[model samples]
Target: MFIVSLIFFVLFLPSVSVSYANTLFLHIEGKNDTLSIYAETGTQTKSYQVKRLQDIEALYPLLQRRQIDRNSFEQLLRELGIEVFEPIHTFIESSSEIGFVMAENLVKLPLDLLYVKEIPLFLQKPITYSFTKINSQNLQFSNTLSALIISDKTADPENGTYFLKKLLPSSAEYYDIKDINLTQLESIQTKDVILISAHGRIRFDNNDCIGLGDEQISPSHLARLSPKLVYLDSC
Candidate 1:
């Protein structure tokens, strides 16, 4: 299975956005346009090379317009790799906490949830989003998840946002929506991990936007935030 395997790299996809999670990725250096993905454990590696890059890139706008679904993401996740994701491109670290990354610039899209083998059930429906954190020094794995969590009052109560609190109860520093802002995030320096539980949806103009109480974070805004372990519980 993709999960149990050590290193599963989705080198490229044809018409979809490709990604997998929870592994240590140093850097990606491939030879041709047709990339061979591999999963690595110790010295061995595995590849999930499906082959779509442009088609996946086109979906971002659709996602922003609130026209995409998990099925679309699930299908896309298995098909393409990107080249530019301004946010979270700094470097990813190793941790037990699960996270997702963009392929190619998959770096630029909404890298929310990650699963092995197949997309998760909850993610099989409509829209829901998530992100990951990183380590620049090494790909060392850890089982701890201590992060700065901003839980929006309007975050989904029955799904992801609700469950994470129960899962990491004491591992995170919880802050109400009213207490957080763009400045704090721009100057963020303390915690290495950040998980935001908020309402993320597309506005009339079709640009991606997340409503975090007084601040509605756009992708451009998301791009400006300092790089770190990030998670977005967008429902």
Candidate 2:
């Protein structure tokens, strides 16, 4: 799901003046036939559909490997419903940070590395999202809360994926955050896999919680799901 904190700013580019007008926030929900998109760009709301989810999933590899071509990139954009329309043929689309609210299993996707016509999307779209490799901080997974950093080979998030099953012990499950509540979250046992890659927040006025659609998962509730791996990769 895409949620943007709205703020306005101005910029002067040499002799020309161009300022950020808006941001595109897209929230994709449901599964299979139920899949739908909820998006917002400025005051305008846009809706789009894919020919088949399989058609889009097929392109994930191209993105992960950073092997992009106009055709494949076009397909991804078409399926994603990102397009520029009238009144403006071309416009500056730049952003500092990019965040994505996606399924835990898809967290390994190198979204920041995506490019269009050799230009990175972060510099081309006024959308918010981001990621990178840390030097001192290791990309980790856990069993019994014991640290297990990715090997140098698998740590290449730029060109590869962090295969949890290959790194963790026993079977695992990527919990789907669809209107999930504390009761459902707490029901999870030690054998279950816990990957909370969602929209999280720290409120000075109130206690922090994991934003899950209309619901919120508290830290105390989250502790109930004692799984072998807890990848709390959130924003």
What tens-digit string does per-residue lDDT give for candidate 1 at 130-225?
222232223222335555667766564544444545656676566677898877666755454556677765433546566766778775554444
lDDT of 2 at 227: 33
Give per-residue CA lDDT, model 2, range 80-120, as digits (tens): 43321211212223322223433433333333334445554
Regions of candidate 1 where Cα sits further than 4 Å from its true position: 1-51, 65-104, 109-146, 159-172, 183-189, 201-209, 217-228
Residue 91 alpha-carbon offset, candidate 2, angstroms:
9.7
| Backbone Cα, N, C clashes tallied per candidate | 36, 6
**lDDT of candidates 1 onward, in order:** 0.43, 0.39
Q: What is the lDDT of residue 53 in candidate 2?
A: 42
Candidate 2 lDDT score at position 40: 49
Q: What's the lDDT of the predicted structure labeled candidate 1?
A: 0.43
